[model samples]
Target: MSRSRKVTLRAHPHGPTPGWAEVDTPPPAPDSTAAAFFDVDNTMMQGASIYWFARGLAARNYFTTGDLIRFAWQQLRFRVLATERSGDMSQAREVALAFIEGWRVEDVQRLAEEIFDELMAPRIWAGTRRIAQRHLDAGERVWLVSAAPVEIGRVIAARLGLTGAMGTVAEVVDGSYTGRLVGDLMHGPAKAEAIIQLAAVEGLDLSRCTAYSDSANDLPMLSTVGRGVAINPDAVLLREARQRGWEVRDFRSGRRAVKIAVPSTAAAGLVAGAVTAGLALHRRRQRVS
Candidate 1:
């Protein structure tokens, strides 16, 4: 009794690109009984998950402001290059872990909770959230899948009360980050592979599953599912979505829920309420210098 809806956003291209060209995609199935997969970065949020994570780290002093600025610039440059090669994926991981050295697994998890409301909530596409809720209301599983780290995924899933989430996992030992991923990056072809493996583990049928994405890079995941809906897809994906007759939509003009930013004081309170030793840890680090 559930159906998929394509929620598109107006693409904002920085640098020399000016803007993204219009795209035409296919229609989706009239009705479907399947789980829906959501891409976390541009698809679910306003921008990249890694970018937000870097900002959060910088705010907490885990990363310096300059480090975060460089990280953001690197991301911008990478998008401009438009390369989907796996080597780029490897390099991204190294960059992410380099700044997170010496961070306790628990502290990051605690900060993720604060940012979940401050940063993550506002970035979720309204149309996408509605579609996901519709499926959940109909008793279908709604999973948030992403290449972002597991802590980031968990924060989002918990906030939304989602059934589950699948994301990149970093190696951890003795309650600290090893700064290394235990497996292949969860992107491009790897995303599709994760879905297939998840289906086997969760006893779900791939032929009955649905996936929603905004980028051509997610083709492997979109193609693997029985139902694929492209939401404001990229040029390359728009052509493929049209060929496959997948549903596409542009939700930029629609009315959306207003998101209020949690004030710095409120965020500090939340962090304090979540952990008694939060401020102590910050002070302790200062005294060591």
Candidate 2:
């Protein structure tokens, strides 16, 4: 089983507003056997949630501008290029874990709550939020499945009035972050494994469930469910969705919906390389000091 943690839904202290408004349409009868799983980045939201969180922390002076730039570049690559290689995933995990090492879990959760409202809330896709709300209206459980830290995922899920969330587990010891993951990242094939275990525990029928995502990296997860939706999918996922007859939703405008051309991608790659070198130099200077 993947080391994804399942968080139970709870009311937020600030009483978060739902992304979608209340509809006059009557809700359907409860469907206890079915559920909907949604991916976070580029699916339910406009960009990477973690990148926003990192930006928020940067605003609070938690890290240097160089660190935030590195994060931003990584998110850009992930969002536009759909780069999800094993090495990239490993590097992201290490950077995130190291940054939070020795921090209190509760403190991180509190900051995540604030950051979600300030940064994440505005970025949520209205169309995707409506789809999730539709599942809720039908009395089916809705869960955000993400590779983000479980605490961050839970905040998003709770704020959106979803059932809960399944996300990557970061180990904690004595109420503080250990800077180590409990298992692997809750991504790619691991996401499929996590939900399979969750279904067994929650009595959900796999065939009755639906999964939504924006990346081809989630092929395992999208394939596991009965219905697969591609929301603002990358070129690879878009092609696969067309070939597989999966439902596709594009909230972006015609100009924005076009795939990033090779020139833009190559330029972004060059910028990322520069930012990465700067971040490395910054880290080296800190160590030297």
Candidate 3:
């Protein structure tokens, strides 16, 4: 039987009003197959998921406006330089984790699903979603691979009717976060590594699998698969795409595609906020916890 479409909105035990739904997806297991993997932020959607989550947290009084600004700056730095250049991504990741030090894991998951369905869902590129659907129609498992927390990734997959997702793992103690990561944030090389592991576990044929992303930060992920498609590529990535002769689809090619990213800046503006928030968090970490 398919997953139930009915969503039950209720107050979470963690003291938040979030809509929860029964999840029917099984974790990855040994299975021979071909799959399509898509990056979530700036690839399938117009902006970063973490950015919006942070905004949600801000609205909930988790942090201040200055915190969000500092966060955005760091995220922008990590996104712009991590793939093409050597720079520590942990600087951005640590603060993002610390931003929700005492948050309950279940609460974040519920909130992410609700926020995505209400705010970020329409922000997802129709063209990108259509591409994923085509893969699903072809009987391929579609997974959303992203640096965002695995919870957010799964929410995106479930909402989009995809198979599964792979994302950065955050550490939790009991039901609350420990403000730490279990491993490297799923960025740059980490994304490739995660896919490799997933492929092995699922017995997937990498030679027949396809991967898609929009940033050079995802170069490793885009290159690891047999087929790589660049969607809404920036100038740098577009240049690389041309050099590699990889297929590319510019969702920003016209005003029509711009609707998915209304004001187009909504996603970008939030992403830029990650950097500012990260910086602020870093400074705070220096003086306090």
Candidate 4:
């Protein structure tokens, strides 16, 4: 005969766990924390965060009119580029990283906040925001996980009034970016890894936590949590959700749906081409060094 062991779950300070008892699980462990991890792109905001930040820089003249045109082109490809082959995501992201080479870290943080308020504020989806708020009201810790720079993610989390966030942390030297990543960008398996590390540090119970995202790229992360929710899912993610019987929420189906306004595809294509070149050049420099 097998003996059963009991486990305990810790409730969030906001209130008692909602429907937690419905599940046949022991009480939470002492000091255990339940959290909600959210994806930043299509999952939260209607579009990509980098694009809006670039647009904000253009409007502020940080990037000249001509520079803005090129950047927009790159962002377009960044948004629509499909990754069929292995390492494709990494190669594509290297483009954005090259763009930020030699920028001061503090400057980026300050600018992200300004840009987020002016441009990103209006793009937040109410349905997704409601989910985040519900978790917050329940006193559960909430975090924004994305491949966008960490500073940008933190700003978004603060604005949303959540606990905190985690994102891609770029390598910095002498107060400026080195154009090299400190670790893997927070995507796919990397996101799951990040959450696992967080759980160890925060004493979170993965089986009692929740994760939300829209891209199939985030499947690894969604699978890591006990409850996975799909918001405004892309075709790939929607299919996976159906197969897994995961909960789905779509905020973009109605005529009143609003997303962040971006530039033309042609403009974004130009920017993508430039970014491709920039990545090649940056790689060459690294080889030479």
Scored against the true structure, residue 62 in model 4 reaches a CA lDDT of: 47
Encode model 4's per-residue lDDT on 216-288: one tens digit a residue.
8899999999999999887789999999999999888654434332221243345434443444454466679
Q: Please write out the lDDT profile of model 3 over residues 74-131, one tens digit for every residue.
A: 5556546654455766565765466446668888788888788777887788899999
Residue-level error in angstroms, candidate 1, position 126: 1.4
User: For model 2, how does the per-residue alpha-carbon lDDT over 107-197 read when each residue is reduced to its tens digit?
Assistant: 9899999999998899888999999999998889999999878998999999999999989888899999887888878889989999999
Worst 10 residues of 2 by lDDT: 259-268
Model 2 pairs whose backbones collide: none
Lowest lDDT 10-residue stretch of candidate 3: 260-269
Q: Which residues of candidate 3, in runs, are more than 4 Å off?
A: 1-32, 66-87, 254-289
- Cα lDDT, model 4, residue 134: 80
Model 2 lDDT, full chain set:
0.78
Best by lDDT: 2
lDDT preference between candidates 2 and 4, better one? 2
Q: C-alpha displacement of 82 in model 1, angstroms?
A: 8.7
What are the root-mean-square deviations of the candidates from the true structure over C-alphas?
A: 15.6, 12.0, 13.8, 9.5
TM-score (C-alpha, index-matched) for candidate 1: 0.71
TM-score of 2: 0.75
**Off by more than 4 A, model 2:** 1-28, 67-93, 254-289
Cα lDDT of model 1 by residue, 184-270, tens digit = 767788889998887887777788888988778799999999999887566788899999999986454433311212211133222
